[model samples]
Target chain A: SQTIHQWPATLVQPVGSPLSLECTVEGTSNPNLYWYRQAAGRGLQLLFYSVGIGQISSEVPQNLSASRPQDRQFILSSKKLLLSDSGFYLCAWSVWEHFGDTEAFFGQGTRLTVV
Target chain B: SQQGEEDPQALSIQEGENATMNCSYKTSINNLQWYRQNSGRGLVHLILIRSNEREKHSGRLRVTLDTSKKSSSLLITASRAADTASYFCATEGNAGGTSYGKLTFGQGTILTVHP
Candidate 1:
């Protein structure tokens, strides 16, 4: 079975501080990885997605960026954190199917609070 | 911009009662998927229904899709307290290209099943 692991379940960061959140999937190769953020009591916003290594697509313009360093390793980074950046960040992975990508599986998520 | 919108931002129901959530989306889709999220946790994929299919069933969950209306509904039967969570609907566009696999999520409906 495939499992996704995300680090730093919760983080408190100062404004303008650098941030790094890592997500890795074991037991799957060449999976599609995504980064989503959910504001308090709001819908999820897709920040970035990668179909392969070194390939990332940004859904909306923002301070955050995403990278897929390996086949199953994805990282979300920011050079400087903003107060608006504080939210629940979720990392998910899905496998490609004949029709499209299959249902996505998510990690526990990283709750970052920028103070 | 968000593509899907779920009705009844919050619902409260007694245990064993049926809970139904509706979602509406814009644009053509390849498939629609439902996900559940416990408080402060990542989402769990519950079910997926292709655009070609009108309805699908899995255990106590039933999903119905209406392409003409560009809407979908998720029905949870005999709900338990454990079923108290936020439910989200995500859509994968039918556009056959790099974007076909990307999922656009809706604002979720929070379901609270009281014991």
Candidate 2:
């Protein structure tokens, strides 16, 4: 069975502080990884996605960035966090085939609160 | 920009009643998927329907996709309180850009099933 792990279930950070959120998947390789943010009572926003190692595609211009250092490891980083960056961060992975894409599996998510 | 938009930003229902959520997308797609998210939790993929397929059923859930209309709908029969959560629609576009296998999500519909 495949599973995803995300850390620091809840985080409280000050404005201008650095942030790093990690996500790792077990039991899969070469899976497409994605990072999403959700505001309270709102829909999700796609932030970043990776199809392979060291290859990442960003969906929007934002205060955050993401990297895929390994096949199953994805990291979301912000050199200096802003108050607007506080939200629920989610990590997800999907299998891509020549035919198309499959359903995505998601991690538990990280709740970041910047004051 | 987000590719899919779910309708009826929110819904309220009772157990034993049915709940339906609709979504509309902007571009060509290989497939469309629906997901469920509990409060402050990661999303769980509910179902997927290919562009060529009009309707699909998984247990008590029924999904319909209309490529011509660029829209889809999810129906939950005999709803339960446990089904209370936010539902989102996502589209996997056929477009080839720097971002491959991207699942763009909509604003989501909040479903509240009162016991």
Candidate 3:
């Protein structure tokens, strides 16, 4: 059984503050990791995804960035948060496979309130 | 731009009634997946249907895919109040671009099942 852990579960930070959200997966190695953000009552936006360590792909230009420091450890960071950056951030993982039949598993998201 | 779009942005139904949601996508896909999200929580992967498959079932959930129509539908039978949540559809394109295995999500359908 694989499990993903994300923290802090909720955060309240002032504008322009630095931010760091970590996600780690256990019981799996070399899995694909992704970072996503969802606005209030809106669809999810892909932030970043990594197929392997030290590799990251950005889907859209935004104030946030992601990194894969270890095989199962992914981190989302922001040097300076914007009001628009406030949203629910999520981390997900899937087994790296050919192309199909891969299902992603998500962690309990981090709700960031930038005031 | 979103690759997938879910219809009926919001749905309200009584418990035990069946809930159906449709999703449409623009490009060729390797597979399409349905996910469920409780309020303020991360998504849970519910079902995945490959492009070659027309229908799939898991317990009370049934998924149908139409490659010709470029659309998919998720059916929840005998829905319960616990099924009240947002449902999203994600697509993994078959096109061997750099975005392979990177799922593009649709604006979800908010399902409200009354007890």
Which residue pairs in candidate 3 have backbone atoms (N, alpha carbon, C) closer than 3 angstroms, thus clashing?
Answer: none
Off by over 4 Å in 3: B97-100
Model 1 C-alpha lDDT per residue in residues B1-115, reported as the tens digit of each score: 7999999999999999999999999999889999999999999999999989999999999999999999999999999999999999999887656553678899999999999
Best by TM-score: 1
Candidate order (TM-score): 1, 3, 2
Q: Model 2 chain A: which ten-residue window has the lowest total lDDT?
A: A94-103
TM-score of 3: 0.96
Descending-lDDT candidate ranking: 1, 3, 2
User: How close is every model to the real structure, measured as TM-score?
Assistant: 0.97, 0.95, 0.96
Question: What is the DockQ for all candidates, taken in turn?
Answer: 0.67, 0.71, 0.72
Question: What's the number of clashes in each of the models?
Answer: 0, 0, 0
lDDT (Cα, tens digit) per residue for candidate 1, span A11-46: 999999999999999998889999999999988888
- Ranked by TM-score, the better of candidates 1 and 3 is 1
Q: Model 3: DockQ against the native?
A: 0.72
Q: What TM-score would chain A of each candidate receive against the reference chain A?
A: 0.96, 0.96, 0.96
Q: Provide the TM-score of the second chain in candidate 2.
A: 0.95
Every candidate's lDDT: 0.93, 0.91, 0.92
Off by over 4 Å in 2: B96-99
Error of 3 at B67 (Å): 1.1
